[model samples]
Target chain A: MKLYALNMIQPVGEKPPPEALDKVMAELAEVRRDLESQEAWVFGRPLHGPEASTVVRLRDDEVIATDGPWTEGKEFIGGIIIIEVEDLDAALQVAARYTRVTGLPMEVRPFQGLI
Target chain B: MSVLVRVFGDVDVAEEAVQDAFAEAVRRWPADGAPPSPAGWIITTARNKAIDRLRREAAREGKQAQAVLVNVAEPVEEGVVRDERLRLMFTCCHPALALQARVALTLRLLGGLTTAEIARAFLVPEATMAQRLVRAKGKIRDAGIPYRVPEEADLPGRLTGVLAVIYLVFNQGYGGRDELAAEAIRLGRVLAELMADEPEVLGLLALMLLIESRKGARMRDGELILLADQDRALWDRGLVDEGQALVRRCLRRNRPGPYQIQAAINAVHGDAARAEETDWRQILQLYDQLMGVAPSPVAALNRAVAVAEVEGVEEALAVVDGLDLGHYYLFHAIRADLLRRLGRREAAAAAYDEAIGRTENEAELAFLRRRRVSVCG
Candidate 1:
């Protein structure tokens, strides 16, 4: 099975002014609805504003939590869905929808059963 | 040599025979006893299997030609095995193939990587990569791309494709998602070793070593670490030193290529005690030269980052503002950081969101999610 990460696009700030959120997610939800038939999608939840998100890492045997997304950037993942497509073209079709909906990008990956 | 010898010595058939021999060994070796020379036993078994297969195939055709050829088939030839493999590589790297297919074919054959492994590395589906491989191999067969080292006249033109194949393999490995990263490195190492006299090959290896040195430190568990966050103590000093030496050698040769220039940039990153100490000016110069040789928007964006360090955030933003890299995560990420530094928290956060949206990496997404929290706070 192919694995794709369908990243939800959102603008920066604690909240994407509810209007911006609605505009973007309307597009995303359309993509979400369209892609469900193409492949299997994992958990479906948009990212909370950065404040609500936590960065977690494992050090030695413990878990470390930090502010949020490690890189310094503005656009962040609002939510995610994983799809198992048959081929890269099919996967690209899924990613293309997100871009079509929001004029943004989503990375497509095929899951290797083993790392 | 009879046509029989050619078929028996063919790469695909030989590979199948060898696989069968190895499988038979695994079954019979335990039942009997380990041969005095296991490798020798396997080679012999495979050759004999090929001869038998040829005979059987001929027998099925009810032709004595097969029996005649088998009788004429000489004892196992030692050098032919390596020749076939080399022949395969030569065809796989033929200039006729697309850049992606070259690396895909190399990884599939030379590196012993499965289609699934290469697909994972490049972040594409397995079936697509598998088709790409098939198409590449078929192209080799259709165009009659020769299975020999390219002629000296063709070398200059084809060298770029060869180096590209090496770099492509390296990137697949470096891309972090695919297991082909190690395979890419192996391909690079082999290319370097094959062209040891050529300094650029060494530069490619050094460059890969330099960047790969920090691979472990780049990610802590599954979370990403910016250059500054990476612990210097965890860095591989051995790789750093070796890569530096190699880059120095390549620069001295004065016949620099993109790989050599890229190696120089990585060398600076590898040698810096801290991100602050990084020789951004030298990197910028290399990027300038790199852009001339291989112009890419990503390179320009990177150069913009260097400009930011030397000049200011506004200047850097302006450099990338009109560029066309809408779907790239790094461009958005860099823009977000620059805006954030300028205290345009709202805009910066928005850019960050754009970066996160572009990328599928969980660690990067998680990091972006948390950054939004801090920006609004």
Candidate 2:
């Protein structure tokens, strides 16, 4: 099953310990290794937040543009990846792997598709 | 305690003894040939076990109140189907417990479904289901979720939860690995018999019959038949008639709810002679009504499909385009079918892959793969 990995991250001033981050990477590696056998495809990685933005607006004949990381917030989203696995059960197992690394909590929702 | 009729006043005591007796039976029954009346013997032995426990408690706790328990005379009448199992179901569905726990416990205890089956019904894992069962039993013991039926006034409110349990039973039957589908059907028959006064009860039984009646035709040449393509001639007339009769009776009662409404919708389809002849207008109207009552995304999805049929494929695509059915296999599969029919082959191929990626059912995944091959090759 394809799943959206919701990496709910906290502020990085309190960044996760080296050991914890190592555990997270190790777990990701193990999951990738294990699920490759049972599933069709896997898509994911940590990101540098959603800094790549293009904002625009339309009028009767004119267009409006704005520069932005529009939403004002304290902690921006640190990362996420869309993964393809065997089922919800397998996706959840991957989520459990992330849960073991305690910098922040993780959530996995099965994805529908792109239009 | 006689050879039967050992009734324990408290569920804790009764269950403890029953577990003990079951363990003993497991040890002995294999070595010795099976007893003629194994259940009766177990009941009797369990009762004695409970008496022994009380005696021990009387000695330890130093308080003797022989007030609650009343040992009964022998029950030698060979085979009147006792309702202890039904009573077990009532206890499981007691309103004091949370709705989720009630459904879980009912499937586990009364339906005799495996934890895996119960989990699949709830779309969770066996481990998760096991934890839920443990927590449910703990709530029953600690929070004192009752071991009896609700009050006369509470019966109607509680009936909804019982109905939900029946629905769970049907789903397990509908997708079970063994004779669960048949067993679930039988459970519905018994439930209808037990709750005859309730129109929805009859309606649910009719629904089960109607849906199950088509199982024979749901697959053709080992491929699952879409409802639109299923051969009308293969549909079971007997089940359709029973369902129609129940819906008519239900309509006369004038009590409307989700199950009754859904059953009515099914009744319309059951009455149809061909795919083209299906009363989509009535089915669409029913879906609109159900959306108001249940308000689930699933109901909305079905409505979209109905709307698609009534209006056009583009309209249907617009209806479901923004829906968050990421994990829902049918959503992607149906979308792929719509796209493929609309001659969007590349998009259709991608959607098929998406559907294949998300689906766990081997049969469905295989079907999608074959479709992908035919469409993209």
Clash pairs detected, candidate 2: A1-A85, A111-B326, A112-B326, B173-B181
Q: How do the residues A9-94 of candidate 1 rate in per-residue lDDT, one tens digit apiece?
A: 66676554798868877877766676666445554675676667778899999998888677656777766767766444455556
DockQ of each: 0.01, 0.01
Docking quality tier of candidate 1?
incorrect
Model 1 lDDT per residue over B74-138, tens place: 44454555555445666677755787898888777778777897787777999999789878766
lDDT of 2 by residue, B117-228 (tens): 7797677888998888888776554433334445576577667778777777667566534355666667678777766778888878888888877887777555667778
- Which residue runs does candidate 2 get wrong by more than 4 Å? A1-115, B1-87, B95-101, B112-135, B152-157, B176-178
lDDT of candidate 1 at residue B195, scale 0 to 100: 66
Candidate 1 A-chain TM-score: 0.66
**Docking quality category of candidate 2 according to DockQ thresholds:** incorrect
